[model samples]
Target: MQLSENLSPPEGETIDPTSRLLAASERLMAEAARRFPIAGDPHSRAYWMEAMINQAPDYFFFKDRDSRFLLANRAVISDLYKETDLTGRTDFDLFPPELAQQFFEIEQEIMRSGEPMLDMEEKIPDGRGGLKCLLTSKLPMRNEQGEIVGIIGVARDITERKRQEQLHLGQAELLKMIAVGAPLKDVFTALIHLIEGQIADVTGSVLLLDPEENCLRHVAAPNLDPNCFTRIDGIPIGPAVGSCGTAMWRGEPVFVADIETDPLWEGYRDLAVPYGFRSCWSAPIHSYQGQVLGSLGLYGRTPGLPSTTCQKLLGMATHIAGIAIERKQAEDRIQFVAHHDVLTGLPNRSMLDERISSAIEAADDANGTIAVAFIDLDNFKLVNDSLGHHAGDELLKTVSRRMLDKLRPEDSLVRLGGDEFVVLLTGPRRRGEQLSVRLESIRKAIADPVLLEGHSVQVTCSMGVALYPGHGRNATELLANADLAMYRSKEIGRDALQFFTAEMASSAHEKLRYQEELRRAIAREEFVLHYQPQMDLKTGHIFAVEALIRWNHPERGLLMPGDFISFAEDTGLIGQIGDWTLRAACRQNKAWRDAGLPPVVVSVNVSARQFQEPEWVERVASALRKSGLEARYLELELTESVIMADVQQAVALMHRLEALGVHLAIDDFGTGYSSLSALKRFPVDRLKIDRSFVQDLPDDPDDAAIARAIISLAHTLQLKVIAEGVETREQLEFLRGAGCDEIQGYYLSKPVRAEGIETLLRIPNI
Candidate 1:
């Protein structure tokens, strides 16, 4: 087939009959041009030529070397000259001076080179105040003597084709910006310009829905007047609130053909008419889940509905705008979740450090002091332990809001995790009274009673203040010193604030010295484990032994766990100590087996910090494998508070440990506030009654009731119950009567050395 026979329309469009007619006319004209000056009367031949040229759809014309029109077809005469004859007219009379000069230069080039210029695209005025793209072909015309005289040109309008290409390209570029995580504002700006470029006499805008305010906020409107946008911005969406707002409210396209007459614009007509916005078309931008996110709007100077092409462009603009808005919102949500507390919506530790460092730098430049205050809710644990975590979370949120309301705008309040907050303030040095007054207001606000989960709750806080340059330099030191002062506040009274002094610094230095020594203790093998036996209440035989850590301080001599366990936890050194104790206990148990002693499951206490490690489960497996001890002979005891911190995570970790054949037990069970539903999910073998409950048991009615309740609950769940701190004979008798499976305390035997345990195991009965 010939090229013309194989011609197809643009993708997704039908073939235009006008295009086919132009093609056929061009072929006929080409042949007719070769056979010009036929054997006939000159006047008759000229009349036939003029008639055929006039019948052609495309613009056909002849121009002299100086770019003067010699003869023009009807299309050119009507379109360019308003049906006037062009026998002596020049291009300068038909086009703007610059455009005419351009045409003349191109024609002169074709005439000078004796070549043809075909299929060249040009942008020219369409006689109105708009542009039209055209594909033109020009050839150097020759007289009968074979000398060039003028040029003949044929031009076809390609405006629609170019517009479609530009729209597709613009869509691709906008998608690229979204894909590469460009800022939302830049993408919106480019999007508005892209739409305005394709459509004439219109301004574009993008408004994102603010769900909190229930209003449309302008995001991008590069071509719209700023003052006009400011007036219309933040308008609440309604059925008749103009194009963009109504489109968002209805979650569909809204077209107001005339701002003055459309009922949708009745209330907003003044806002539009004064700004020359006579018409508007808006489409709601929807998320992938089909929820409306915002709207993309176009405003025109004339009052009429948009053309078919303009409508298509608007649809594409909304789709692209939707993608960009959704992506940006998702990114913002992720960033917010990472830096803010879920319970109170306060900034978390990560943001706290950044803000503190910035505040410190500002203080240094101004030769001022930065106050770092550490705030700890005094009775938060008591409230949480009694009211459950849900109520606890509610109380925390209320307290956070109250404190925030009482603080200055320049001050920053941050949650450092679990009932602890840090406030950073900067001012001139030696403003202790001023700082104290401010902190007192915050303290009073937090102490106010609040209603949580329908229960009247009240709480107080302890605050510690430390200043820059005097307390210490940098965030770490300042925070540490402030923590020490907060501890002092708690020691002296429940609700109060304490400023860091040289005395506190001296105490911190001592603690720091001990921390350094503890680090060496781990490396030099200066730590030892002691085992306390748990005796079966029915048979009076040793069933298991609990492992306890004691720091063998070089300078201070041997120290019990009470003297150093909390210190280790506070310094974050408990993880390392816990790992060492695990391996050592496992090794000792296997050695006892090798020594022909009875096998007793060794119960090792897992600290909260150690239990929360990402690799904690793997660490347990490693300890068992490396020590040559069977997993069945090892029991990992975790406190109820540790397990209850994150119940789902604790449950999952417990299951994984159980899968490895290790026994699990909840230590100090009755002390932590875990819901029955959460507790039943634990795959534990036993629950240990806390020492506090067991210490005053049998005589103290409340303690006795708690102990009996725990034993019954454990038995109902098909698990064993163990009582620790049973020092009195009466307590042991009462526990045995209450159906306790095991008992461990000084009453059985105090925690003894490894050799001491061998002797006790041999005796079999405690």
Candidate 2:
């Protein structure tokens, strides 16, 4: 019998003595071959075997059947037990009882079954009061006798691999949770739960930093005393504070393995002792750029350090903390942007509407009055035109500041775009006069001068004040009434204040009705023309007729110029009326010619408001062409105000009309703001003396002298002169002696209908 078979060396030894001796010789050759594997023959089998054994990182060894180590490769001898010598050693000598027992069991199973035990894990004592993970594989060795004799084992250190596997699992879980779009609080809670489940001997809390309050608040905590947590809810971050605070202050991880001895717990020993937490570890929750947002910490009731697994779990929790904080901040920023104006940083129009509506409801319930004043600046256009828009923007900003300063704590001053503002004054009005006085005060407050870019700019606003329930019962009506009153204040010369009244509301209604009536009247052809005869001053013979407008109302019989002329002028309807008058006068003159009547020149008056139109000349030319009237026989009568409104445009229009062969006569010549020098610039065929001068003519010396002077001026300018409203023969003879070109009045013939014009023309000479 061989000595190896009878010796029965402890478990894990399976090789016989002869085979063991062969393995020793083979290991020596393997070392020599490993040093010079590529020498002599690069493809030799010994070189290939040496290359495969040395390149492998696992510990490889062969043992005898008596359980003694016979031959061990350098990896097995130097790495497996941190020993350089492994010859004649048994597996029991290299590992502790538990590790040795597991190794032998695996070895015996592999030997008996003649199969390899692949990748079995066992923790071996590291000889430094810790354990290391090792993966071992055992394969049965066969002798030349075809019997299983011993086992050759290969073992690998896999401590880091297990750590990496756990890390990968945590990352996958974290990624899945983040993908589900959980709330930040839920995500933080989930991170804590994941840590508790994955790591052993550790419990922790999550504390978020509140930058605004400059403190840490406990967001989540597990396995901690409720009273202790409440006491640490708002701990400030500083040096030598608790683990979380110290980590945040230092912007790095802090490990206090023994909280009782660490200086960081010097001031908070009671906080640590009562909680039964002897050790603490903290990692800062930081952005990728290293901005510390908060901290994640673990607490251990015993005075022990955190294992590697617990440390890795803390790192993952820190990452999750950063994600949660960023998401919460983004939500806050979005909420702020929703309610505030981007330009002014004030509440926007929607906010203002809600506030106003709420204030109105409160006033109604309390039986109080709320005054809403709408203020609009006067001459703001002049400022914008002269100083440019940049200056205008600065002016608006300055005005807004001033308006805000004038308001009380309870009052709300809102800007309704450029140069317009509204102030809501809540409470009961003392009286109507008191409200008026307060409004005047507000107007004056906004009227102050502002210094802009070294220039003193003055601005004044017209205010319209409307009372709650008195002027309007709702928000919309109150605003409308206030706006109407503001416009009325502007009408009565701006920079004034007015209150809403029943009369103003009635006036607004009347305006609406008038606009509707005017539109319908134009469409229905309800307007007509009357002719007033103009006679020769010296012969008393009617030679021409002046055309005047008359509106025949469906129910009111007849309406004169004073009825709707102002409204027409204000609404730009005068241009249409002027066009109709020109066409009708031209048509009547042409009809007289076609009817074999006298060739009387038909003159129609033009308004100052109508002369400003660019298409005036074209419209007149088209009317003349359409009526088949001779352009020379058609006369346009213009007032002094009409010629003086815009002299350049008027001169150009007169020149254009003269080129078309139409006659131009200045009507009401001396009654307007016109100079003799300005008069000479007009191209005219005749000058008509106004009825105001002729009404007192031949009796009042001033009136007669004025008419005579005008007639003489017309003669000197080579323009025909006509005297209007010549009611008496003495007035007529005086005009005749002055050599007036024409005279027209009741003394000649009143303004009559078209059918009556022939009777007046057929009458005997006066």
- Measured over all alpha carbons after superposition, the RMSD of each candidate to the real structure, in angstroms, is 18.4, 31.3
Which tens-of-lDDT digit does each residue in 1-766 have in candidate 2? Answer: 2434444556887878787776555555556666765555444555656556756887778876665677677676555567777778776887777767776777777777888888888777655555668897778889999798988878888877876786678666665454433566667776776776566557778887778776788877766777887888788889988898899889899999899998999998888777678999999999766788889888888887778868877887798678657644533333333333323444544345566788888897887788889889999987889887667777777777776776677778776656777778876554554666666777777678877667789989888988888998777778878998899989999988888898888876788888788777777878999999988766667778899888887878789878987778867788788788889889888988898877778888888766777888888889999999989888889987778778898999999989999889999776555554456678998888888778867876756766766776566567899989889989888888878888889987789988888777667575
Candidate 2, pairs of clashing residues: 9-66, 13-67, 14-64, 14-65, 14-150, 15-64, 15-65
Runs in model 1 with CA error above 4 Å?
A: 1-88, 127-129, 142-147, 152-154, 177-186, 361-368, 378-386, 428-441, 444-449, 458-462, 488-497, 503-766
Best by lDDT: 1
User: Among all windows of ten consecutive residues in candidate 2, which has the lowest summed lDDT?
Assistant: 334-343
Backbone clash count, each prediction separately: 0, 7
Candidate 1 C-alpha lDDT tens digits along 1-766 = 2546535566798767887766655655555556664443434446567767888988899988887888888888777547478888887877889999999899999999999999999998776667778899999999999899999999988888998898889888887777656788899999999999988899999998999998989888888888888988789999889999999999999988999899999878887899888999999999888999999999999999999988988888888888887766644543454467656888887577678888888888988878889999988998889989778988888989998997777788999878999988765534346777888999899989998867888899999999887887888889999999999999998699999987777786788988998889989989999999999988888978999988888789999998888889989999999999999999999999999999899999999998899899999999999999999999999887788789889988999999999999998876455554355689999999888778867876756766776776577567899999989899999999999999999998999999999999899566
> lDDT of each model, Cα atoms only?
0.85, 0.77
Full-model lDDT, candidate 2: 0.77
